[model samples]
Target: MSEHKDNAVAETVLVSSSSQPSQKVRQTAPVSAWNVLVQGIALFSDGYNVQIMGYMQTVMAKLYPKQLTSSIKTRLSNSILVGEVIGMLLFGLCIDRFGRRVGIIATTAFLVLGIILSTAAHGNTVTGMFWMMIVSRGVAGVGAGGEYAVCTAQALESADSSASLQKRRGFLVTISTNLAIVSGFVGSSIVSLIVIAAYGNKASEGIWRVCFGIGIFLPLTIFFVRMSLLDSSQYQKHAIQRRVPYMLAIRRYWRPLLGCSLAWFLYDFVVYPFNLLAPTLVSGFTKNPTLLQSVGWSALINSFAIPGAIFGGWLTDRIGRRQTYAVGWAIVCVLGFLIGGLRFPLRHVFPLFVVLYGFFQSFLSVGPGDCNFLVSSESFPTPLRGHFLGFAAAVGKAGSAVGTTVLTIALNSFQNQTKGQQVLFFIGSSISVLGTLVVIFMIPNHPATLEEEDSKFREYLEENGYDTSEMGLVEKH
Candidate 1:
């Protein structure tokens, strides 16, 4: 047994040394600025659709008052997230097994169709319209969920394939992933302003339909652009021939999978409720805010997040993924505790509270908000990249669903709305504390490049007596 172990280790060393190429060959398709922009814009559609709904919810409750109770409104808000969880799981498998192109096209179609249905939803009864919108939003959520997986995977893998861009991969990928959310916030703000200006008092009845209608344009543009995209070259070279079975991939990489997924879960659970309910939270402080006022404030809050994301991306490249998250989460934890404890004193100057909340929220985009996807995209090998990313993302969406639903219920349970918000903030702060610990102890430090990580993985398999050739890996030599 000892001799066999020694021979296996020797063979692993020989294979690695022999396989080193004289020059690093581009193993993936050429990544262009156009490719990055298109993927980023495609991702923007998801954020626009998701964030727009938060603004629309205030109108929805009034328009369908007979049908939309507080409970039903919560369901409407959460429906899309629940659908997204399903979409991620399904499309993750599709992208991994068939191809990213297939996943992109199919998911976009679902998104477009769902948007159309939602825009046109009407019924004689409020109940009918309510269910129709709920179902339609859920369907749209599926497409958005799938987009999160494929778009992030494409951007990160494309960046990884280029040796020149390897050191900046975290920043590039983070920008591409996060820029969309900022765009969505800005877009939603603009639309809300337009609708409020156009209709004044009559905005509630029609503004939401217009917002959903606007969502169709970007996905339509993305569909046409996606037709021209080539599959990831790394996927073509490594995973195309011998696609790892999903179960096998899970069994092999459960550690990184759990780590990435839970980190995302904790991050989303804290952020989504705060963001999605921002308009409502703002309304609680100010009396009878107009649609523009609510969405405008929410957008202003989100605008601050853009710089944090940009900074976080650069910071990730500077200090490494783990340390960036630790710092960001620590800041959030401290702010969360302070704000939750001092809700009454801060209520007198609500704008100050908004700024403080926005600042802490921005730190999330800087830390876990950007890093979750970055770490998820980087930590896994190509064959199982989609599967792992999708699973982790789906888990994150599940956190969103819970955060929106359970947290809403918890907040409503308290007689005083301010106290309830305090409790919610306390919960979010506690989760961030846990997230900080998880980042330090669980996730491994990423390699400088994807190629290096893949090389080490192959070496591990060889040393463990796995047959590399049988797994369809070309010997690097």
Candidate 2:
């Protein structure tokens, strides 16, 4: 048994018998197609619920005609953000200790619960429905917050630990990010068609309910599919010992935790307001009163954004994380300056601005928590990876909550909606510029491979005066 253990650990690349003695070769495992599809589907839920709210805002405005104050409107929309913070924190911790499969399944359940609760609320009074919307959105937000961190970590870890896989990691992760933006387009289209069909030629009071109720179907399908999603390959090792504690992971991986958290803070500060309030901005510009019309336009805008997201991810892999994200900021600055200063009234200028906004927004979708999976999954050894990711997720969720709350305050403080929209665009753009600088200067230029990271961890443990011999690797004196 001891000899077998030694041989397994000592095994190196096996050259083919046909190869010359001087010929050197490498062996790599095949990528799992099933795993990739499962990962994509699992991640779809994250964007599905969040994007639906963007389309649902106009419906909400009609349902609560009197409560359109910036503060109330912002609060109702951001309530999900608050819940997402909690869900991100909880799932991160649970995934580390319990397993990734549990975290994914549990969060999906929250999404289903939210849809059910939201649907039930529509049958009640306006105020009752508002509170219900708040609760449901919160549940959906929590699920989203968890899904972002866990899914990225799971997918990256499953790939071959080689330079080739490292290069492709960005692309694989991009698939989920790109699809999520596309989901916004899908949600918008669905809401548009439903609203138009249910009350064709005249908007009805119940159209919003129908839209919210439709959210239930996706989550329900996910619930059935998720049952078969066992723990990811990365989590199996930690799942067995049950020895890795959440607190220990936090103490051990503080550098990555801090870096990921701060980066997400800046990204979230920008994304939350922009995504949740985009439709509102369109309405402010277009003066369109029809919910179906607003949703259709918003959907069209998001479809344009999806390509930008795919492009950003490709750029991340081709250039590097820092340069790719920096370019995204440059685009944001250009778009922000124009949107803030330009006053277009349905001329070609307005549509052009809308298209630009959608295009630049894709960069943000990649920024917040997208590639941090590389950092989080590789920063810690297999034993502690899940906990670190979960903690970072919680931090990101907190930033989103802050952004949402700030937007609520900004809009509510002003009596005019136009002023509120301008304020949001200005703040979101400014914060993004600052964040881009942080990523450029503060973050390391390249990701560390597994062996490099393990060696660094040993050094870090030595410097901090902790014994890491049980990590099954040598330690620096």
Candidate 3:
């Protein structure tokens, strides 16, 4: 009887209540400022864990000299992507089925275990280290899979309650995404500085362990700190209502799922190349040590890339969703294509290219990463929201896995071979360009709020000649 009431409440909230002016005014009311800090800090941990490995190559190489062989090096480098694949699939299911709170706690536990295992990988035995490294990274990946979807969803949901307080929902929700990028930059900087300070000219074998140890520390800190916050009210309500099962989202909302999956897939195809493969790419291009200077340079470049995200968010509010997406994507296509193909012989020009690369890459990653959650969260009612997010994340991770594998293949095929980076540049840029076009044409350009989203989506389908009501209505399954 309670569940039915919960469902009725959810339907009312989704279909009509959210659109009312009173709700919007209430949404604008201030939330506890502390909540924002906790969410933002947790987001930093997410970015740190996801991208930390990129800067730890030298230390890892020293610790596991034997496994640093060509074949194994690529696998080790790409291991997080492999783990992320599993995390995306598993956590996606858990978040939808178990409740967002449960998924958050579960993913945090994974991060803790991942930290321990990653630390253990610095041990003397190669087999133990290899397997443990893989296992640990996979754990982190699981947490990452949970982090963006749940965190962004929760944040947006919270922001929604206070809607009249702030007109810019995109700006508010994107705080976590922006902070994550900043944290990633800071984490890489710390790792690089530690290596440089510890080793001076020649760092010892244990330095990578220190770096991983340091990387592990941030996420653990975040988990403990985050334990105090309440679960998203939206998610809590859904958990109470139990409106939809996970399987039904696949059967019912498959069109939005497909649209989201394709859009994210293409975005990830390019993003993983940089996020997972930047250090490796740098190693191939120059004879520089794969640590301090290279990572530092990338981090510095990324710092300048902040505007792309801020601008994307700002533009989304001013010009509308589709136009903002269209503008950013068009830049990505043009700038991305030019970044690789037009090579400069002068050594100094490489830094400029790196900055440009990071700028465009940041735009691509940040924009869609935010949109993925925003769109998925608003498209479904509270009951199936988690599942929709999880499904999209799972699909996105598959694309990430493919992108990482491609990077490894590209590296192996062109290792020490001349013009290898040029080829990669071409491939990466081309993917971004193509992805931009796909998003422009395929994705629904609707605001991701409960009141506006369903109506907008229905209208779009009617205009586009896709009859969703007959094929299968998106009911509370």
Residue pairs with clashing backbones, model 2 = 70-412, 71-412, 92-390
Worst 10 residues of 1 by lDDT: 9-18
Model 1 residue 123 lDDT score: 78
TM-score of each: 0.89, 0.79, 0.80
> Which prediction has more favorable lDDT, 1 or 3?
1
Clashes in candidate 1: how many? 2
- Top model by TM-score, which number? 1
lDDT of 1 by residue, 174-258 (tens): 8888767666766777776787678774546678888889999999976877766655555544453343444545666788889
Q: 21-71 in candidate 2: lDDT tens per residue?
A: 322222233433344445667666556666666666666566566755555
State candidate 2's TM-score.
0.79
Worst 10 residues of 3 by lDDT: 19-28
**CA shift of 401, model 1, Å:** 1.3
Clashing pairs for model 3 are 27-161, 27-162, 27-163, 28-162, 28-163, 28-164, 28-165
Candidate number of the best lDDT: 1
**Cα miss at 437, model 1 (Å)?**
0.8
How far is 269's C-alpha from truth in model 2 (Å)? Answer: 1.9
Q: lDDT tens string, model 3, 229-332?
A: 54444444334223333343455567777777776776677666666555554554478664566666556655644566666667666666556655666667
TM-score-superior candidate, 1 or 2: 1
RMSD of 1: 6.3
